[model samples]
Target: MKLKLRVIFFLIFCLPGLAILGYSAKLAAAAHGLTSTGLTANGTIVDHERQTRRRVGQWYCPIVEFFHQGASYRFTDNDDCKQSRHDAPTGSRVEVVFDPAQPSRARVDSFRGLYGTSLLSAAIGLPWLLLGIALVVRVR
Candidate 1:
């Protein structure tokens, strides 16, 4: 009975926590790589895409545009799209950091835009991981 409970609990909590932690680590690493090895350019907020969810309500995601190697590239900001529509009005300037080899894949050069997903995921995952570890240790 004790071993069965431990297995069940580990399967339910620990595995998912580990998965989330790994995914967040990957995201953080990508951001770090881009910042370290990418090219910097001035970008403009050309548009906003309206995104809605029941839990998150509605928010506008900034669509950014920049020129690289004489060609223009546009990419949606991948940051957590929880900001108000007014947060980034069109025509506003933003610093863009992109892989020079793949300019289309770019990110807004801001702390939140670059690292928000990783931070949020880590914050959510760490507790579940700790709880799962506690459960396993206590069960044993």
Candidate 2:
């Protein structure tokens, strides 16, 4: 019983914690310039939407050249606009941040932060964690 409980506990906590840790590591990597190109993109709002607070999708933004390491970094807005009704002009500027290691893996600057995405993951993950704990306790 003790071993079972221990395994259950580890599975419940470690898995979620690892997920959060991995996400944090990814963000830290971006912040520390572990990627290839640190480029900023000038985006034109090809489209827009404003329905509920839910995210729809992302489109292309724009690109700008900036100097990072010893070379000039070229950033591009490769995000597909969230599905919405708010219309953005074709030439609207959309801020884009890129992964230095993988320049191709780019996204809008506004969407790069870790807080909101972390929260969303936690909101969905915590419940399952709690349920696992509850089950373990009950079974014992």
Candidate 3:
């Protein structure tokens, strides 16, 4: 009975914690790669809008436009958190960081825009990981 419970606890906590760690690592690696090798350009906030969600209320997303190699590209900010709409007002100029080889793969050059996912993932995953470790120690 005790062995069964230990196995159940390990499965419930350790497996998910490992998965979260993997996800967070992937996010951090991607952000590092972009910030290290990407090119920067001045972009304009072309549009700002709010998306309504039942659980979280409203999230703000901004659309930005920039020119690269004589061509124009527009991309929406990936942040969907509340108050994100207020971060960039329309017509405001902002920095854009993009892959030189693929201009379409770009992001707003801000801490939140670039590292938010990785930060959030780490924040959530760290506690789960600690708890899983504690549980494993207790089982042993």
Evaluated with lDDT, which candidate comes out highest? Answer: 1
lDDT of 3 by residue, 3-88 (tens): 77678777887788778878988987887899899999999988866777788876778888999999999988865344665655
Residue 36 CA error for candidate 3 (Å)? Answer: 1.1
Better of 1 and 2 by TM-score: 1
Candidate 3 residue pairs that clash? 60-85
Instruction: Score residue 114 of candidate 1 by CA lDDT.
Output: 92
Candidate 3: segments with Cα more than 4 A from true spot: 80-86
Please list the C-alpha lDDT of all candidates, in the order they appear. 0.90, 0.51, 0.81
Clash list (residue pairs), candidate 1: none
Worst 10 residues of 3 by lDDT: 79-88
Clashes of each: 0, 23, 1
Question: Lowest lDDT 10-mer window, candidate 1?
Answer: 78-87
List, residue by residue over 1-140, the lDDT tens digit for candidate 2.
Answer: 77787687768765775566566556555544522355665544443333333364444333434333455544443333334324435445656556656655555556443134545555666665666666656664
Evaluate model 3: give its TM-score.
0.90
- Please say which candidate is ahead in lDDT: 2 or 3: 3
Q: Rank the candidates by TM-score, best first.
A: 1, 3, 2
Predicted candidate 1 versus true structure: per-residue lDDT over 79-118, tens digit per residue: 8364686778889999999999899989999999999999
